[model samples]
Target: MWRAIFRKKLFIAIMTAQFMIFAFDTTTRADDVSIGFLYTIPTLMGFLIIERGLQITIVVLSITLILTGCFFPVPIETDLLVFFANRVLSIITVLITGIMVNYRVRMEQTLGDALAKERKASAMQRAFVSMVSHEFRTPLTIIDGEAYRMGKVKQAVSPEDLQTRVKSIRQAVSRMIVLIERILYTSRAFDNKISMHLERVNLWTLLKSIGRQHSEVALSHQIKVNVHDLPVSIRADRNLVTYILDNLIGNAIKYSPEGSVVEVTGQTNGTMAVIAVRDQGIGIPEADLPNLFEPYYRGGNVAGISGSGVGLYLVETFVRMHGGRILVESVEGQGSVFTVQMPVAGAEPAPAVSTGESSFPDKQ
Candidate 1:
């Protein structure tokens, strides 16, 4: 109950602060800036605790009243009303500021919790990937040595047996490489270390190329790969887009049952290109869907699936890097759709973006 009340107050206060900040301009400042300055000093000082905020507010406001006495020629009645109204405004602003500060603290605490969980999962994944690589690498090395040495043996090795073991080593190495790269890619994306090498590329052609790479995964699951229809062109970092799609399609196959459908759809809407990966895989929970794009956040139903949980994280980061948004629609136990919307280079948004108001002057 306490938390609920705090959140409601915080929301109202922050919104009000935002409204004031956006609305106040030097040209539009019908109210005196000194009054604005005095009113905000209290709220700023009062950010953390009601008691502390109120104390600082009072101190600052008192100083303002004293300073104005020396600088301005004011009548007694007008001065009284100004003091009364300013005091009321300061009280409201302080409460609002305290709420906003508290709400942010709560949000950060929640983010920390989620990050800690993800870190634990990543640690476990790192351990598993490490142990498996070490375990498999030893055997693979032995097999590879045996295969190479067999050719020099006085007794001839059956070409069939030699070929089989070599094939197994190759497969193991491929799996290890894939797991290692996925984790690494996720790390870079989360850290915002990915640098774009942007170029104008045909989206249809690109999808077709990436689609072919996943053909085997699709064939194994009896899922069709469709890239015949897509936006003809888009401007993006080609390699990043490829990585995004590869991870997305791989995950879809990894989660879906055999014979389930996996579809890739793309089209240009206004100034953005939307690429969606729709899968009839085990769906995500409604509650868990919001965190899907968070780094290392694995879905509840995907606990047993094969993933490092960085696919969607990298996907979202890459899309956002290009000035776009990603969205998801999923139903637990039904299926999931991951959508990537990328705005075209040099395109303007249709709607005017609105900013919030603050009592303080703009910092920049």
Candidate 2:
């Protein structure tokens, strides 16, 4: 704010200096057309700093007319038409300068806004890299340790035990793959390369597949799915839908304690499909809920949790791409429910870009 005020004051000072120069020359050298042109300096400067550029131009034009008339009076013996024509030419020049000044100012503003967005995107990219490194390390370490154990205990370990170890390693790899795919998809989305190819998807089968995929993680917890009554099929982008479910369920498992229930439910309401992932986990803080979907934003309760804070952000993005909305309802200790509402096939038109805030239930 202070910087804006300083710029305004500086602009006024520059304009004042230019007007003084014009006034001095008018008295000493009134016949000089260039002396009258000095007023354009202040008029253009006003457009650069002030939003009221048009008003400033009019003020400068009026002042110049008055000062010029005082000094360059039309002699009663001189031809009146010649004097009027000269004055009219000077006024036209001032008007053209004002228009050009305003145009330049608008162009500068457009460039400034684009530069700001570029900077923000750069920051997000840096955060994503750091997060990927941190998240990948844990899974890679688990896989490496298991491989080392298998190498050392070869033949000595029973076939059953060997199978279990291999399975564990595979599960770790699976987790890593999910994370990597999300990163790739998100990158594509950023590049505007993500496209929705809607096809008929069986919700029941999809839910069961997601459950089975995470069976390793579910060994210590329960993923209760209740989608039997849901529409047998819905038109949606299968890959994007999978991404959304993966994040939601994966998060529910990650944040919840061992043996906690992570419930998945689906239903149909009119032309919309409703799906929710409710978890008995460490619930989001009411204060932090509003920024939950913001890129790289983690809640206060997520300390020590292994998360990049990008999962929910990607979930929101994919949901919006389907012309749907995601809503969050949480309590500090009672857990949170993420409810998604998307239109059924051909129910609503999806746009290339969407604008809206994700819904957050009021804190109770």
Candidate 3:
């Protein structure tokens, strides 16, 4: 409430109204220039309330000019020298007040901006810690279970059983490694340090590799690849493309039922390479769809699910880094589909991407 009173527009309006009130006070015995001292309020407001220095200077000068004209028409009761001196002193006071107010406002604005940025950084840090703790649990559990089973066998476990436990441990370790890498990448993204090194990449080969890895890591979910229409290659940052594909497929598996088939399709659309991932999962609500890719935002339906809500955020970031866009379509309790479009290799080199609102496809 107090801040609103100090806003430049409101402050200016109040000061102007006050000056008008003074101008109409017909019972005043003061000299005209003394009444014109009311102009000082606007000059002080221009410096203390407005953000643009040049604009405030113009407003103060206009107010001074108007007040001078109003005073010129009034007859002075004192000697001419005294009248001139008084007006000069009032003008000097206005200028000095304006200068001091401007300096104070500038310093306050700088301090406020710094404090706001610090608060935002602190919030990100808290989210990062929570995500790390949540995401590491599954892998750590897997490793712990495998270790426990091996210890229980007490040298009587078969060679095949030991090997199976070892493989599970390795898989768990791989998952932990990937989770850590994502945390690091997300931190860099917050700092806007994401750098892309584009190159010609084979689409078929990349999709196949991602499918194989998903199948190996998530044995319960199956990934189906459909790249019959995709070009052999496209210009992109190979690592970024892999990151995008990995997150989409991983999210599909994480959200879907066991044995559900997640479809990965790639094709060429105009000069762009389009990749779509569709899953038979509990879909997002209409309200949640808009916030799906927001950092640390999880859907209402995912209350019991194990997720940090960073996968889609990372996917969106990586796609934009390739100068691409992502689209999502979902119906609650039915399924969800995510489509990514990137400029194809040999087409015009894509411009650097910007952080903007995501667009969703119209539901059928």
Query: How high is each candidate's TM-score?
Result: 0.59, 0.64, 0.69
- Compared with the true structure, what per-residue lDDT tens digits does model 1 show for residues 293-321? 76656777765455655667777776776
Better by TM-score, candidate 3 or 1: 3
Q: What is the descending TM-score order?
A: 3, 2, 1
Q: In model 1, where do residues sit more than 4 Å from their true spots? A: 1-3, 6-164, 225-229, 346-364
lDDT of 2 by residue, 1-364 (tens): 9998997888876765665565444433444566567666665566566656545654575656555665654456545554454445555665587678877878888999999999988888888888899999998998999989877873678889989888888878976876776676667666665666666777789878897777664699898888875787777777667778877988888888898999999889988889999999999999999999988778999889887777888889888877789999999888889998877773255465323322211111
Candidate 2 wrong stretches, greater than 4 Å: 1-101, 153-155, 208-216, 220-222, 285-291, 294-297, 346-364
Candidate 1 structure, TM-score to reference: 0.59
lDDT of 3 by residue, 1-364 (tens): 7787567567666665654443332113224565657656764665565556554555465556546555654454655555555555665675678678877878888999999989977886787788788778888999999877777764587888779888889878977877666677776776766666667899899899889888987898888998988988888766777778877888888888998989998888988888899999998999999988877778989987877667788888878767779999999888899999988853244454323322211111
In order, candidate lDDTs are 0.63, 0.74, 0.73
Name the lDDT value of residue 142 in candidate 1: 64
Candidate 2 residue 51 C-alpha distance from true site, Å: 8.0
Candidate 1 at residue 137, lDDT?
A: 66
